[model samples]
Target chain A: HVTEAVHEYSIAHSTPLPEVVEQHRARSIDFANRVGMDPGMMVNTLQAQFMLFLAKLIGAKKVLEVGTFTGYSALAWAEAIKGQEGAKLVCCDIPGPHTEFAKATLLEAGFLNKLVTFFEGDGVETLQSLPVDQFDIIFLDANKDGYLPALKTILSRNLLSARGIVVADNALKQGLVADATDKNPHAANSNPGGVMGYEHIDEFNKFVRDNEQLEQVLLPAFDGLNIIRLKQ
Target chain B: HVTEAVHEYSIAHSTPLPEVVEQHRARSIDFANRVGMDPGMMVNTLQAQFMLFLAKLIGAKKVLEVGTFTGYSALAWAEAIKGQEGAKLVCCDIPGPHTEFAKATLLEAGFLNKLVTFFEGDGVETLQSLPVDQFDIIFLDANKDGYLPALKTILSRNLLSARGIVVADNALKQGLVADATDKNPHAANSNPGGVMGYEHIDEFNKFVRDNEQLEQVLLPAFDGLNIIRLKQ
Candidate 1:
């Protein structure tokens, strides 16, 4: 029940995507189609605007994105950081043709700088292996259930810089993350797994809310986004 | 249309509103109900978290709000500015019992001080009359159609500081701003006035996009928010 027409209109009213962004997004979609994978992993382009906006808001010089599915979001951060000298973006995803495809897209976008590092392994492993402990922003968009562990590791490792923020995508998991009942439209129409798929996001959301060092805002837009700013 | 249950669950996961915020919101709702006016003018509480998050992200010290409805948004801006020494928030709205109610809420929140000022007059006039030449942020939640004039006034007054932002609420106008067709759910079910109500927002959204002096992103979240960052 996304009400497709209204959503289409919302996207239309916002800033239209740049040619590079649109090209990269289309490349990812075509790759997903060929691989028989879910294109839903590619975030909506409207959300790309939100990320770009957030990056500027924080004056982020460095951004880390877990889940570099074809690099749509990675390119977004890169675009956001453009004109900032020595800015960097690190993306982590398992080594695969898809990962290589994303790299190619980044290259095509002309954002393939000396600083854009790709970790070709488990996102968590990459997270642990990063040489730097400070990132202005860490974006979690990998496996949904892995978020809790990632959160714990980020906190334990003290990976975020002062005033840094952590953004978790799909925190709503198609509204099923909130309304777990079978009667909900997303739950009834597609989520045959009941609430199992979104349990981790639910846990992560609560952890963000309950944590003393973090202040969280769960935005109910496009599958939900958790904007968690560290109080420390 | 908001799918109240899922939305409530989403809000439940976000940071819980403070007692003062909750009290003001409740009071506003009660007054709206009593008067048979739409309390829908009041923003959803979840957006309060976003506002607070943005305020901190920018380290905002001075905020200018063009619409001070029962003061929910004004109080939100006030709460966001807390702990910053000498931070100020100026609100503009027509004089009425609603504005009076908002004043009382600010008084109760203990945020009324030399820093907080209220302008009881037309929003644009107040904008032109402001003594300050700059602010960290300017928020527009006033009359929907007045946004163009308000934008002109803010820019002519040079009210926004460097790297400052302008957030206009209801930029989507319940999706009608995006889609005005009878096929759209909101337009068909609720809006009998065609797209007349949101013409200003529609124009403003386009103006933000087409204008070279600003870079804009229209976030299709809680009633839609237009984040306009001054390029100058």
Candidate 2:
């Protein structure tokens, strides 16, 4: 568990995200609020920073994101691979106002065509449609229930490279995946989404942990981040 | 903050460390207890897991560790880079029973000369005497006050590869670096080491943040792990 002071300090000391990415995040939150949607769908700033660090750490040139909520994370990924040769980011999200906004925002950020490819459709279908190539990084943050299915597709199709990593967000779902009882404050919240998604997330976690072909580390930081890789 | 249930659940779902490494960790704790040393000086299992993931993420071949307390972390590093060609782990620590214990342990683990090279002396001095070759990863976990100087030397001597990362453990020192007041329980602990190292860690954090040449993310997990790199 992290205290507010400690959290603030950690963020302050972390590398600042690009101004464009920050603007996109703020705009996404505003849009979500205006549309009566939970802005929590977007990755937080610290998570964004960590993802950027990860992308660069692996010298990621090919990235795939199963979810592209308002393109904030896509922009961060674009920033990470901007100058690299032949770097590409593929994002999939169901068609809607969110997808439209993401397209517009990323175009404005100069990443739409140059670096990112947006697919408006079901996540698994989109994964199936992609060319048979290995992605250095694959990020899963879409519908909770779709996580395990998407992962199965990714692995069966060999979309993840030999040395690549898969980063799954909300794997813990506010710790509800681990503890769905009344003790978890999130369980008593007005929104039952956390409790509802508990079964799906827990299933995904267990599947990843038990799958002999994969290895993962579930971090308690944030909503529980799962960094997974194929066993070497 | 994280609850105990969440923490335990997270670890349970994460990948397990190698049996040898786990045995070494347990032995290290027993040795520390017998010698009246704080076993906490060694990294926790979760941190070791994270480091292993990090090394594999970056495909690290050359690693430098400024601290070698009982060789627990060094052993983990050796495991991470084991099969890679020319993989090498260089460790620096003061001459003492700890170093001797570490040597014997690593030798028994079949990594002494095979993958690790141990140095005995002041951390900074040992770092200065090393060759000018770049290391893919450099870990700082020695004397708190020596962090800044060691970093400066590392940079000045071009010891870190272009895309390399420097992971500094205990960068937050039980949150005292952020809030060194009675409000922080660590401030009142019998071990003044946290309080004593407060300024140094704080200074190091600020220096890393302010340096235009370096970018860092200080994670709040596990007493604060700072992942730093040169600006692109």
lDDT of 2: 0.87
For candidate 1 chain B, which ten residues in a row score worst on lDDT?
Answer: B187-196
RMSD of each: 2.7, 2.3
**Candidate 1: tens digits of C-alpha lDDT, residues B105-224:** 788777766557888998888887779667888999887767888898888778888878989888887777656676656765653333336767778888888787887777878888
Error of 1 at A167 (Å): 0.9
Deviation (Å) of A14 in candidate 2:
1.4
> Over the stretch A1-232, how does candidate 1's per-residue lDDT look in tens digits?
3356556665665556667877888878888999987787888878887787778877898888999988888988888877788688898888887888988878766777565877888888787778866788999999877787888888888888788888898888877666767666676565433333677788788888889988778888887888787773
lDDT of 1 at B97: 83
Clashing pairs in 2: A1-B1, A1-B2, A2-B1
Please identify model 2 stretches exceeding 4 Å from their true place.
Answer: A189-196, B190-196
Cα lDDT tens digits, model 2, A133-231, are 899899999888788888999999999998898899988888877676888888866243443376788888999999999988987677888989998
Which docking class does model 2 fall in? medium
Docking class of 1: medium
Per-residue lDDT of model 2, residues B28-58, tens digit only: 9899899888888998888888898888878
- Distance from true position, residue B115, model 1, in Å? 2.5
